[model samples]
Target: MPTPWRPFASYNLWLQFAPPIGQERWHCDMKRGFTKARSREPLVATLLATDTTPQRIGLLAQRGVYEFHQDPLMLYRSDAVTKVAEILQLNQESAVVQERVISILKNYYSNPILFGKNIIKLSRGDEGFPEPILIEQGNYQFNLFAAIDCIFKEQDGTLHILDFKTGQTDFDRRQAYVYLLAASFLYPTQPAVASFYNLENQKWSDPITATASHLNAFQIEMARISQQHQKDLQRYRHSPSEFKRIFPPNPGINCQYCPFNSICSFSELEVSA
Candidate 1:
């Protein structure tokens, strides 16, 4: 009646397992263990449910953009930012969130990047999980998830997959590759390119395209990550006490910002002092 469960892979999972270029210093495998492996546990579940400030800002900013496009005329209004803030209830958020989100709304109002484009899809950012693209490569099968923010058609009839970002995180080309891979399956006939746009600074990345060989290589990589992650999870389940070993911790200054720092045994949040 229903399809059987399968391992999953996504840009987020890839980032968790392997940090982006130059960001390896802050990558912590144990954080992924707590997030994906032990997430069902009461304590970990509670911690995971909490939305950090950055997460909140990103969500609200995306909603703001969604609201603006909902009523195109609203974008032309002088009080466009104010109206979007009310819809987002930005006032209820912390001062920091309110300030940043309001600025993002203002930025979008002034520029409105997608204003006249043929936008086919625009996400509200709270749409939970997207339907996965089932990928079967030889004996390995897994679900590939790519939560694309927006997809619009270019004048040349190319499908453009645009991802919205916030804060200071650099654009990781791997994410664009994942989207391209997903697009290959979802819109096989259409030529596609992917790029990133930072809502806060209004920065745009160059459009990224891939060859058949590139997509094939990425599929292989995703298969490897999916299999490796499942094995790690299975190992953890058999021996819960071996979490640290299964997902080794890299503790240091970065632990201060980790959501699981308070509960992480290997956290360097405190010293002998």
Candidate 2:
């Protein structure tokens, strides 16, 4: 059986490990999706789509009591917000979601102390760093698929790779490390640090530093695991008996959210008594 190719470096791919690999394929192929009357896409897209900086400086006077200059286009951002609402399929839009997104943006933007230059020219935007940096090596191709939310410099000139989250974060460090790894490659000469900002939880993770040797090892591991998954998938597809031998229905933590739970014998779905 010819194995389909998938780059191993992605954080998403590792989340699914079906004893083997073909079980996930079977689950996806057999599962169904339904439409809902109200979708949250509008709120999410609106939050994602607008640039909050312009609004903060131009409209909200978020600089507190300090004499501050506003962005010329602050009022114009509301149009951008509404446009995003249209893109997300919310005809009327939700006031609550809009307020939440704006609040997060204002909070993040106002904290110039945390985001601003303290003692050094570390704010890379202030430090003159490039946007949308790209890095590709071996079978791992990373070209803005997973974006670094923000990249800047610390007072000590440590390059920082930041990821911002709007929801509760319960351990997604692997993704943060991947961002750090990419940043390391992008800035070969500079020391790089990685961290996560959970906006909803109002928490910032302790920044981590990455070594080239460690990043290279992770790259090797990703390639190995990805190729192994493909190989396991081939083995599982050989025959139903062999498939069962390799990819047995053994469900545990992943079962509750598994799309294939309905068809999976080991998922422990309750019988109609």
Candidate 3:
């Protein structure tokens, strides 16, 4: 089997060839850890994931977020509704938190602008996609995976790819474009547009159309990055014991969020306020 490299949906720092042997070692070591045991979710992450379960409104609702507003009650008494509570470690405020979460969903999904699309595919996390899209350039092959929030069609048959964002983190357009890149090939017959919608800020980004010219440019860039990653990967594979000198650690604020922060030698940043 060909080793599958992660698709470049987000321009993650670790995905690129980080300078110095230390940072590269850190990146490779973290990936090695991922192949071993799946780490348990930290309490902080569990708390955040539980609180944000309503982001699934896009997948569960008939008309994405709009239908969620119309029938939020329908989602009550469901696994989707209770999974968060179950992960909360039986806190005394579980009931209150559940109610508040429901209210937050109601407020966000109530926007009328979210309606009027004929949506067929809905996904959250890794649930909505099928086999990965293979992006091959010469000897480089990247398996592109996109778990799009919602895939809907307008009256005129234009497909819209939606990505739901709950937090205020700054992001680039690469995410939507990657989604579009995979989707364009997934539904080859249809024209697709991808955009991001922030639930907390209630801000919708301008749609980025997926066209031959646009995707061609993106393909060249992706192929280039994949080739670089391929080279980096070869170094580690050829001299596994020499990874210390090949890939180095570059740690800062981001290390605080990494699961391996405790294990990494350079992890020093604080994650909280």
Candidate 4:
């Protein structure tokens, strides 16, 4: 029989392992534990099942873009935004979700950045999980998962990987790095660059390119994180009661926004007071 599935690494797992620069105070390892370790627990499962407002809007906005490109004439139609809204069933969503998603649809319709491009891949954002890239360095091996949003070839033949954003979240350069690393493996001979575009505000990030050394460094970090996360899972299995010690919590004003806040005793004790 094939060996057991290898550990996995992704930009999301990297975020959970450590906070982005200037945002360390809001980092909570326990949230990672709740998400990756205790995800099967009923309460945690329920919370994970529900999409937060930001998540819902992002998904709908991405779907809206996909809908527009799905039909060549949809973009030119006078009721383009309304048709995408109907396709997205925005009427069923909450008022806030409806309003923001509609705005995003309008923004994309007005701009239509990807309107005419040498497109490679485009995701609707609801596709569960992407296929994993098996990576092996020496005896250390793990799966690297990169869910790229869109990929198109530039006029110069360089592969351009674009990630879409919604809301006020700043573009994390690390995410762009991960995309470039993934591209290096997926299209070894092709030069590639990554960037971010905010659909809500129409902000576009500068194209981010990485050197061979930078890609190697990212791979090393990804491998380390994969092994460490596997060790964490094993530790949790051995002593479930020591979960707090295994994954410490830093409860603060941000706890109100944590999905696990309702069940996290630390957040309940610290933030509620």
TM-score of each predicted structure versus truth: 0.98, 0.52, 0.64, 0.97
Q: Per-residue lDDT of 37-128 in model 2, one digit per residue for the tens?
A: 11134643344345343332222222220111123343335454343334333333356545655455445444433433332212211122
Kindly report which residue stretches of model 1 are placed more than 4 angstroms away from their true locations once superposed.
Answer: none
> Which rank order by lDDT, best down to worst?
1, 4, 3, 2
Task: Give stretches of model 2 more than 4 Å off.
Answer: 1-7, 17-147, 155-157, 240-254, 262-265, 269-273
Clashes of 2: 3
TM-score preference between candidates 1 and 4, better one: 1
Which residue pairs show collisions in model 4? none
**Candidate 4: where is the Cα deviation over 4 Å?**
1-4, 268-273
Instruction: State which candidate has the highest TM-score.
Output: 1
Q: Which window of ten consecutive residues has the lowest lDDT sum in model 1?
A: 264-273
TM-score, cand. 4: 0.97
Among the numbered candidates, top lDDT falls to: 1
Q: What is the C-alpha RMSD of each candidate to the true structure, in Å?
A: 1.3, 11.1, 7.4, 1.6
Task: Give per-residue CA lDDT, model 4, range 1-273, as digits (tens).
Answer: 964787999999999999889899889999999999999999999999999999999899888988999998998899999999999999999999998998999999999999899889999889988888888867998988999989999999999999999999899999999899888889999999999999999999999999999999999999999999999999999999989999999888779789888788888546455
Model 3 lDDT tens row, 29-52 = 433322222224364344334423
Please state the error at residue 25 of candidate 4 in Å: 1.4
In candidate 4, how many clashes are counted?
0
